[model samples]
Target chain A: MTTIAPAVSGRRRTKSLGSLEMGRPGFAWAIPATLFFGLFAIVPLILVAVLSFTRWDGLSSPELVGFENWSALLDDPIMIKSLWLSLLLTVLGVVIQTPLSVLLGVWAAGHQRNRAILSAIYFIPLLLSATAVSVLWRALLDPNFGIPAQASWLFGNGNLFGKQATAIGVLAFVSTWQFTPFHTLIYQGAARAIPRVLYQAAEIDGASTVRQFWSITLPQLRNSMITSMILMVVGGLTTFDTVLILTQGGPGTDTMISAYYMYEKGFRNFEFGAASAIALVLVVVATLVSLVVVRASGYDKMRSTLEGM
Target chain B: MKTRFTRTVTGTAVLALGLSLSACGSSDSGGTGASPAGEESGQFHVLVYGDATNKVEKQIVDTFNKTSKVKAVLDTIPGADYQQKLQTIINTDQAPDVFFNWGGGSIAPFVRANLLLPLDDYIAKDPGLKSNFLPSVFNSASVNGKAYGVPMRGTQPVMLFNNKKVLADAGVTPPTTWDELIAAVQKLKAKGVTPIALGGGDQWPTLMWFEYAYDRIAGPELFQKALDGDKQAWAGEDSKKALTMLKQLIDTGAFGDKFDSVKFTDQGSPTLLANGKAGFELMGSWEYATIQDFNLKFAKNDLGYTNFPSIAGGKGDPNNVVGNTNNFYSVLKKTKTPKAVGEFLKLMYSDEFVKASLAIGNLPTTTNTEKFLDAADNPDYLKYQFNLVKQAPSFQLSWDQAYPPSGIEPIHRAVQQFFSGQIDADGFIQAMQALPAA
Candidate 1:
């Protein structure tokens, strides 16, 4: 017993020494990465943060202006409207795309014969760049010589969803088309991970297909749905390229997203201070939203549930 | 995971290497000092706006290099994006030693920022330069009595028509008066021919029409007053009359049904006049090269040039011309040797450079270069020069080039809106007034 105890303590000491060695290797890999991130990402972000509190015309050195840029943001109607529009797009994208992707994914998974073909078809949009998609959709949604116009003409035309709604609808549709494939892949993997025994047991107990899907399939896919939802929310919040190329925040700034408005302010008007302030606000809002979504969706609980299943 | 790590390392190494190499190259190029022999040896970078493949620009640059000590490097950017590129370079303190600059408000921002060096002292010491360049050409380059650039060429707006076709179809000669021009347009339209082909699709071309039309109606005095911030109402009766006349021309379908859709450079509209597709085109002297490229033939008498038709009740003279000097070169304030740059400018304005520019159908701004305009060599060139000097009361600068940057864009947009029927006379005037005055 005495010999075994000494040996056990020696093994424990060796294990602790091995952990210290592992920690050194981890830090060796981390130092370069940290340096890189500091140079490119952290430095630029800190610079932008500093510039947000200063008045800089992008020429000459910036002058510190305290909270003037932040105060000005309250009175800027265009920026406020753009912020609201961005939030609306983010909410709508998540609400509409997340369920559609899961349903499509589940249905595609059941059709084993054409699974590859259907997946390829669904993934076609993901191949296209945002600018290319924007151009293609811009042509498709143009008021003149566009697919929508021709369709409306056959049905008799009068302001489809009233001009403002038409723009929002088009933006949402394009965003969905671009993002659904990514979510669908996630959901398909989740669906495949569901144990076949659960379905078999439900079938033996006289549970119908719909009931089996609700009880077995959905419960299993909860973790993936949460993951896809988070991705969708974050992606939608930063939507800029498609909207920039398609509408340029036009029709009287009705389609201006926060990112697009910031670009216009910074590059077009040389209002870097104001743009940086807006960017800081966007970062804060995005962080708060992610936290709220992660907590409310019970992401950790779902992850544990999936593991237990 | 291993592949991703390798890829990230490769990307970082490449980015750092590329940035360091570019920094080294720029510093090396910039560090070359001026030679003591009044010759630039290493490189003299010139930033120009246009297609680099342009024959005329190539010939001028080639001739200048062969005759001078400087090895010229031409950087050509498209005209639409040139200002943005130039502004970025200037802001970064990486301005080219010699760069092309448009005459008026286009150069004002650079001048105001103290980015451009004043060339007045250079011009003052050179008697040959003072004698060779036209007074008005020098005037165009001067801002607040200080010269910022050298005038390369001058352009004047003129009426171009298919001599045989237009005159024969109308059953009359080219119109010399406002009434006659209207009658001629009516005659041409009756026969299903477009009288004038103005590409309203491009906003700048549409703005040119307004400038020409307004200059003919209001003359230089009142127009200068308006441009000079006199605060006189531009929506007065005279301005309304001009707008109404412009609208009347539009109503008569003088520009034809598809004028708005026609791309300015393509579809052979400019070439169409040379090819006899239409009656007349109101264009600047720059069209001569294009006309020559199409191999069009015009007798000295057949080719007609005139000012925009004057309004019967307007105060402006019919002979008044809307024109300005073209893009000119200016030396940077940070140049290591200003004398070498001045010498290079002198070489560019020499007789040989003038001849090369004139041979390409460009109007030489130099007074001594009139030798190239001899009737025996080019009768059309000589006649145009004679007509310009005699007829034009004063060469009014293109409004786009003359106004401050902030003021210029709004006027351009206002004119475009006016031509598109988005706004009427009073509304257009109000929009113009709404722009911040200099």
Candidate 2:
């Protein structure tokens, strides 16, 4: 009864504060932030949405074309193929980066040997801008004379960037190489925060290294895993600079993913109306995909883990 | 605690906005001119495409600034990004009063949008302006018979740049006919050298082969027909024959296995030409200067350039030329100092300008340029190009630059695909046929 009385009073005081928020100084202070976001973010988003239904060449005023751009974009073969490739890339990115980062993070965080040096080596890719990394990879993968191309004769002498399969594969590998370090750092931080005393308790219980990781480390790092997965999916959807520099969607549109296709259409083709439609479509898909990832990664399970801890 | 957290968040957000606001405040608009064109303003901006010739442009601007009341400020956007940046800023507040352009269909959109000033009025004030330049070159800068641009730089004509020593080693002279070219290709291949160094990765370099081959195949009329929206012209026999001839070269392995990965802009093809690896590279006349900068001895002793070979049965005159006519300076309609810009352009044809251009290996388009040919870095090369252009029955501008700006990418893509064998001749024809009618 004593505990229930304090909880009930606490709830009453929170309700009162919520009701009085309109008059509060904090709420007044938040107005500026709200207004800034509304002006910069919301307005542009609405403008793009409106433009998706118009025919605009950017030189003149936009003419409303009613659902023509959306229908045309949906009917485009290149857009369809590019959209599929985008999804495939997103799936590949999440599937590849998640497990590898978790493994690396756990190994570095849990192991006492050379952890600092090893993590730093893994972080070198994160230090390079996407443009630099892309140009480096392009030179390194030059079929006739690149060091990697010459050395990889053990595979075959087929041109890497010119062939369909190898082009996408090399680009994906380059993207993964650059971004995995980011996810690893997240997991490393999460692993470090899992309470060393719990690990000590498991050691006393005669738990093997792998067993301890499976039991405690993965569970404790659930939120970080979900956060990293959502981030990577969004990033993969928006991937541009690296692919643009490396390929420009060459070898006959084999590597043209959605964002790049949208760019080609808007900037190169002067079809901003069609590009706007593509941008809105990508946003919707990214949001839905993020929601799905959050659910599948067990957002409820993560909340329960937090509560139990 | 919650109140303290809100305070920190607010402080950080305010700090971030303040920082961004300050960052945006950089790039101050140069001194103001609130009056109309010809009204006295202290300064005006002139944007030029950045290249090896930037020093020459800078000298001209400096000369203009020394005595003129309205000083000219030079802004240069680097080579590859120039066209893209110009597009974004052309309709904006930051657009230069006078800007560089390729003229012709390249500036067709600007003219159509009423954003470019017709220079007829300025030309009337000084008849020497139009009369001082070559009729052919100057006419290219006109849109619908009204001058919108002034020829400001050298002419660019595509030529077959070669390594003389490599051809000599194979016992093959620079081919004057298509049959001889095939024979030379065969001889060169037997001697273990790539017959042609094609930069398929850059794509535009590959389009040179198409331009030359098409001109040699069906003459300039067919290309003009296609550009004028004759879909039937693309399906014509000459177009098909042109594609077939191009395919034959690709099938012969004249470019070798790795040509698709070699890029011209990154010195791949040029390196092949300067060394003994490739016998020939069909490139602009700029190839001489570019190679001379790196390997002077090879450029001076072994670099050989000649006209694109004539096809035996072709309807085109053997003297027809193809490439860029030249670069031009166009005035924006909103310029507040048209008279000043016109005055500045008068220097384009001045004897001082011709001497400065020749010193840099550029072949100026001024009719007075012929008299100054001996001043060029290589008199023989300059004379050869000038004669070729002057005697030419027709001069076909490279199709990519001749078409609307938005149309260049697809054309390059189509040419690259044709060279790579990714698409058949029908696909190539369809791509060309799809270009927006000029």
Candidate 3:
């Protein structure tokens, strides 16, 4: 009843202020951004959806093919395997990065001077473009000339890219190294925003540090976790530059994730229609995953974890 | 809180949009004139692959522009992105009047789409254009008996390159026959060196082995048949024999265990040879230039090359060669300045062109190229390639370039898998059979 009372008064206040032109900014302020988004994002997406139904190589005029591309994709063994690989890589990213970043983010959120210096050094990798990072790691892992040659006992021929397991492992490892800092920054900001009084109260209750974190810090980071996971999901689904520079979907298409497979199909094979189909599937999956995460986590309700604190 | 959530959703949407956006190439209008071949009023663009060799192309363009009223503009896309970018713009109004390509499957789609101007008329106007180049090389750009391109760059026939000092230390000589090659490999292996430095990671380097082996065992007709939609050609006895021979080479530890992780583009395999870790490498003629760029002393003195060893009873001619035939400049159908384009192409075989090409270590296919051979950066190597190309009965285009671009991935995958023992003879055959028809 108390929560509902403020909401009813807020609606009345906004309505009264609306007549005096003192409420929220009018929809006109959003027109430019809306137009830009519509032109760049919405229109292209609609066109791609239409293109998925046509059979067209780049040189020829597109012909209406109905559901031929979709049906062919459904039968494509590589497409199925690529989907599984995408899922596996995404799961690996979330599983490995979530705890790691959370801990690092919390630690970096401290007031220690040394922590600031170390975190700054840790963020250097995040500054490099994905292509640069991938190229650096590729050189470092070269079997005959790189670190592998100096430590043959540990590397054993350094066929990291020659086998499927190791190729995926490399992709996951490089991406984690490149992206963990970014998610850590998100958690760091969120951790700073967590009211310090909650900690004080927990301390007075004689709670241990780990207990305080489990009960207060973890619960308070629920919103940040959802935001970070959604980012990881989307980024993982579209992981292209690393895979291209590192493995190139090689070792007999073992690491052919969906995004790269789409590129190979569209650009290399000139099967634009099939590629568009794959692109649409990626979009739908990413959107649905994000939506489900938001819905399942009760994120849309915007309930405050500190509601009665 | 709502604003933050909205921003996150918007950000996710943007990321998803990027995937589909990249799937479709940019359709923005280019800065070039939109009018269809606006006569002599505007410049006719010439797009070539961007690389160190571009200086020769630039000089040629300047020489062309000196006399021509409809001036030529040289545009370049970086080497790696050239093919993809060309495809994206080839069908648009932004398409260049003349573009460089590997010919064969590279320009086949343009021909099928009627976007290419057949060069037969140009050849008829000036018979020198057709007769100037070697017929074996000239026919590479022809489609269905119609001439479509004029050879612009040097031929890149794959040859067996060796570390001469390493071979000498191992008491071996460059092999001339299949038996001798095997014997040499054994000696090199026994000498505690890898017999060959293969950049299997690059995939295309591995394809070279399959290309020469198939040509040796089955002749150029087999690949021609396979490319012409005869899938059974891959399943034939000749194809199996070629695959078996390649498997034998791999199993003999010819490429060593780490070949799959070494790449030629990154100086991996080349370093192996230069360091005497390996004895030989089968590579394109440009390998000389590539090695010269990195290890000049070794390239100048120790570099050795020979034709791929001949198989005794093979169907292929002993003198047959397989590699990139040469790059060609194909004119688009919409060019209004056909007269200017013809005059520009005439310069391709001019003495100046030949001299400049040889100066840069490129062996021009022009008949007059022989006269300029002595002035080349490396006269002996240039003369050897020129003589080899001149006497070769058939200059088989690489299998990847011989088929449409769609076939590249499958061909590379099949060869790489065969080398890595991931696939066998039957599996390799099936992969080849599945390639898109030429």
Candidate 4:
């Protein structure tokens, strides 16, 4: 009995009560949450997945066609084009918005005078709904009486950048304008959380202001940067409302995103099976990219490191 | 711990309760269910595509509700989104008992799906209906000899609506021929006035120009033959001439430089004529109602409607007009109380409905509707409609609604591209020729 008590006590010494107790309430809370998520998100996703394997035109009973819809998506040229466009937009949006947002956040954070006013001004577009933004940009980009055309005329460039490039640029620019503010707020919060001493330490090491930003400020904002980039990628990939309202995937499908194409296929053409397949492909790609982003940012490593400290 | 558990349980219960309530609400309101009591008890739910604020549709609906045995409930969706919404409802089997539908290609999908109740039986039983409607209008609703809808109005292609004051100021009467029209437009152009009010922003209106020009050059037979897949070239010599003439008008700034930015339904085109900024507008008979809605006034004689004049030495006839049966009403196949729907249809085609419709400048499809056409006694302007229908040798459906969806939407896009100069005359012809033959 004495030998067994010593062995059990030795095991108990290594396993802390705190570690076991920490997640008990979480498990208790997770039951209803899991039920809710199962009912809404998981169940709907499964239904869509099952539907993707079927040959149904939204009106009739769905018949399982195995991998036919997936194969059809692989062969569809328009679907391929739309996928490429969505990817390009997502990459461009993230590439442009991240650094711009970080810079804006850093600038806005350091400046005390009129900080609130500047923040509000920067956030106005974020406050406007997507529909309103589309309408406003439509007027601003109108070839006849628009500000862009007027500027082009004043400067003697036949167009702002020529017709095709002009439309693409406008779409990318509007997307960035609408989303950058959200990222700015995220980065600003992250940047504000970093102790002032880190920048001071960088300065003491003979680093310039830009060097300090690259080293201290940016590195500290790693998690937020990853978060913002993921959001931007997902948002850009799923963009429909702005494109539908503004261009309707037109001036010749130059700005047709995957989401817009799905909407057209599902609603306009009533090819729900094809749309579901496209949606599944989008989800898989987004999920894989999100995993890579989270891993690369070393979020798991950071949490462990913090725990160790 | 007990309090936390109680709070969690209560929250879950509330959420569950909410979900159940919402589910109930959606099932009752959104899903396919029995018609409302009013609809079951001889009331008709009439869904229309037009301006809800327009007194014309309201007056007709109100009169029908008051005077007829069937009560009317009118739900007006905006013209642009109406078709899409109607299609969704029809597909879901939540369609209203009676709803407005465009007569030709637009209704073909519903007809083919068996979503609409064929009116052949109803028409046969009610002999008066067979005689009441014009042959052309009746034919528009018939597909392979079975009627699926009842044409309620008449439609025509863009005609020249001249602003008498603007033309007089430019020292010109309404042009009688294409050359005279061009000369008048040129005269108006020289005076720094817009020659024509063109709403190119709405791609359909822009396409109407192409259709009308083609009809005027190639005639209806060749055009129908082209749609029927008998012709290999849309850019035939006649089509080329039409495109050249259209391009000439475009170059002459006949449509204002900024016409692409204007919305079609905002009266941007008609405003040019009404405000005396333009001499003529290429529009349909429906423009009379639009003009009246906008509070634009002109003497009945001053507002002249003329066909797009013949191309000089063209193979087509000068007097031929592009026409179709206008919006029609269809009963749902799933209606439990079809008698109520039939009664509503009766009221819709009744004498009072015809008179009210005509009073608002809409030409009724009913034969002898001309008797109710009081253009002289009333402020309504339907003289052009009466003249066009009476004088036409044959009427062709509007290109947008003339063929099946597979054939129609692509043509609309092609016409817009043609107008936008993306495709040349030959290219336009080749592209249209490639459409699957009807």
User: Which candidate's DockQ is highest?
Assistant: 3
**lDDT string, candidate 4, B104-211, tens digits:** 667776776777788977877786666777666666666656787776654544577888888988998887777887888789999888788766545567777777
For each candidate, give its TM-score against the true structure.
Answer: 0.67, 0.87, 0.93, 0.79
Give one digit per residue, the lDDT tens place, for model 2 in A1-309: 235435545666788688788555667787998787666545555777898999876666789999999999878888888888888888888888889999988777766778889889989999999989998888776655576455765536546666677778877889999999999999988887666666777999999988998998998888888778767877787788777888788776778888787777776766778877887776666656655665566543455243323
In candidate 4, which residue pairs get closer than 3 Å at backbone N, Cα or C atoms, i.e. clash? B235-B429
- Colliding pairs, model 3: none
Q: Which CAPRI level is candidate 4?
A: incorrect
Residue pairs in candidate 2 whose N, alpha carbon or C atoms collide under 3 angstroms: none
lDDT of 2 by residue, B321-389 (tens): 888989999999988877888999899999989899998888888888999898667899999999888
Q: Which is the leading candidate under lDDT?
A: 3
Window of ten residues with lowest summed lDDT in model 4 chain A: A300-309
Error of 3 at B215 (Å): 0.5
Candidate 3 lDDT over residue span B1-438, tens digit each: 555675578555665656346434552223222333334555788888888778889999999898888888888776476787788778876788999999899888889899999998888889999999998999999887798889998999999999999999999999999889889999999999999999988999999998899899999999999889999999999998998888888888889887877899998898889889999999999898888888999999999999999988899997999999899999999887888999999999999888888877788899999987886778899999989999999999998998888889889988888888888999999999888998
Number of the top candidate by TM-score?
3
Of candidate 1 chain A, the 10-residue stretch with the lowest lDDT total is A154-163
Of 2 and 4, the candidate ranking higher by DockQ? 2
lDDT of 3 by residue, A166-259 (tens): 8899899999999999999988988886777778878999999999889988888998998798889888887888999999898888999998
Alpha-carbon local distance difference test for all models: 0.65, 0.80, 0.86, 0.67
| Greater-DockQ candidate between 1 and 4 | 4
Better of 1 and 4 by TM-score: 4
- Global Cα lDDT for candidate 1: 0.65
